[model samples]
Target: MLKLHFAPNSRAQRSLWLLEELGLPYELNRMEFNPKDLKSDEHKARHPLGRIPVLDDGDVSIFESGAIAEYILERHKNGGLKPAVDDPLYPEYLQWFHYCEGMVMPPVNTIVVHTLLLPPERQDETVRGQAQRLLTRALAPVNEAMEGREYILGDFSAVDTMLGHAIYMSNRLGCVTDEMTNLKAYVSRLETRPAFQKAMSA
Candidate 1:
């Protein structure tokens, strides 16, 4: 069985959601983000940066939300949460899968760093505004792309799990609005999924 190291209200939400969607039997080892807890050598061994959402599958250990999502999807492609490699939509599926990390995360990270992670004395107004603007711009294409579709590939797949997290973050940052109607509806649709609800409540 898979062993997942996770914590609530963190990136680990994505991993948990994926596991639930795949119907994979996995052990959830919950960790709290305390100085003493994260400082332990064991935790550091799982994640050099002491991040949550690490997956220990027997002898194989993995970190990073995007990597974990991909790993799970690939390992269980027959579970119906992923597109087959030869499917016509496979290329777009792979592209959007990676886009969650490559395109969406940078601006999100900037927002986190500028708004919450940095000390008040070190926070830069210019950086915050720039990050907000860039994040908005980066997400505009997604809104446009989703205008006619209920999901990224027009069918549910791991891509939805990936982008749903970004959409959640955007909503939290007050970056979503009626102008992003399709994107907003997409998120709402995802929230209605049983797996997503389970992950959130877990």
Candidate 2:
């Protein structure tokens, strides 16, 4: 059986949501969000960085939520969420899917580390401010693209989960505010998905 190493409110939610969307049965190896569970030698064996969202598929173990999502889609032959290689939307799909990690998360992670992860004494206002600004710039295009669209690619796809996770995290940091009407609506739409609700609660 497929097993997912997960922690609540982590990037693992992406994989969990995708799994639920695929309607596949998988084992959830829930763990606390702490060094004791994530940084342990046993967990490290599954993921070199000892991060959450490690997927163990029989003898194969993989990390990185994006990679794991792709693996699941490919392994399960569920192409519904992904555009075919020959499809024109394929490039756009790849772009937005990767944009979540490559473009958005850097600033989001920076803000998270500076504002939430680190102790108040160790947090730096300058860094947090810079990250917030960068996050704003990163999300502007996303908000614009979401105008008149229910999903990133105009249809419900895995790109939603990939980019949705980043948007969700940014919202938690107060980055997605009322002015960003499209994003706020987009989030509301995503939250309405049964799969998204299942993944979040899980």
**Tens-digit lDDT track of model 2 for 143-191:** 9988898899888999999998799889889999688999998888898
Best by lDDT: 2
Please report, as a residue range, the 10-residue window in candidate 2 with the lowest summed lDDT.
72-81
lDDT of 1 at 49: 82
| Clash pairs, model 2 backbone | none
lDDT of 2 at 4: 95
Give the TM-score (vs. native) of candidate 1: 0.92
Residue 134, candidate 1: Cα error in Å is 0.6
Error of 2 at 160 (Å): 0.6
Error of 2 at 60 (Å): 1.1
For 12-70, candidate 1 gives per-residue lDDT tens digits of: 88889988987889998887756566667989999998888899887899999888887
